[model samples]
Target: MEKNKQPKLINPAELFDPGPYGFSHSIAVESPSTMCFISGQSGGVGENHVLADDFKTQVQDALKNLHIVLQSHSMTFENIVKITLLIVDHNQEKLEIWAEEARNVWKSSFLPTSTLIPVSQLALPGMLFEIDAIAVKQLAN
Candidate 1:
């Protein structure tokens, strides 16, 4: 028996185009049993928070925090279907660095749908980047 063998759900092909310029190969869930919406995460480590002004460092910290949140629900990046990245200064170099980090974290098995947005500023004055994610747990029938 297959896990996602239910009938009444919207098909992925109808909801999203599989081949698009910026779209990934991830399938959007029709209806998920559990959904996790993570808040925008930054690179700050402490309670008072000393954020790294560097873009790569900020990306790293944000990914780390994302991992922690997913782990709490016994989930991993593989379960993540969508991710939105907000950057204060979006650049080719920063994107390259982020791609490298993403490869390390997500590995080859799963590549979640993603979106990157360049913003003028964030909530924090010195914050360079912020990342938020949406994950759904695929349960067996």
Candidate 2:
């Protein structure tokens, strides 16, 4: 049997289209399913946990880590309903890099609802980007 998919997205009238930015304005979940709130995931790998230096690399690594977590739970990017992004020293360039990374992850129409937060610092030094997600893997009958 096939698994149930994520909720349907709704883009109603009177709102500016967010397509160019590779995200939807909102996501609506109306069915019975299991929602998972993932903790913040940062862009670090290996035993030493070395972080990426540049903005783009950090964003990519962060998303890769998030992917690993989702895969462990039998989920994928489609299972993600919302994403909260935290970035230190954020600027328009960083935002563009982030949007590019996001576009590279999810399909053109499957961008999860997201919120970008600019923070002064993170739990660790040299941490440029951190991301957490809310995913729903629909329960079977």
**1-141: candidate 2 lDDT, tens digit per residue:** 124556444332333343654654334343567566666767776545578887788788877777766665567899898999999999999999988888888875977899999999997799999898888877787
- Candidate 2 pairs with clashing backbones: none
Per-residue lDDT of candidate 1, residues 1-141 (tens digit): 246633222112212232343433232233545566665667765545478879899889888777766776567888788899998879899899999999989887779898999999997789998887888887666
User: What TM-score does structure 2 among the candidates reach?
Assistant: 0.75
**Residue 103: error of model 1 in Å?**
0.6
Least well predicted 10-residue stretch by lDDT in candidate 2: 9-18
Backbone collision tally, model 2: 0
Candidate 2 accuracy as lDDT: 0.73
Using TM-score as the measure, which candidate wins?
2
Model 1: per-residue Cα lDDT at residue 100: 94
Q: Give lDDT for model 1.
A: 0.71
User: How well does candidate 1 score on lDDT at residue 83?
Assistant: 91
lDDT of 2 at 85: 93
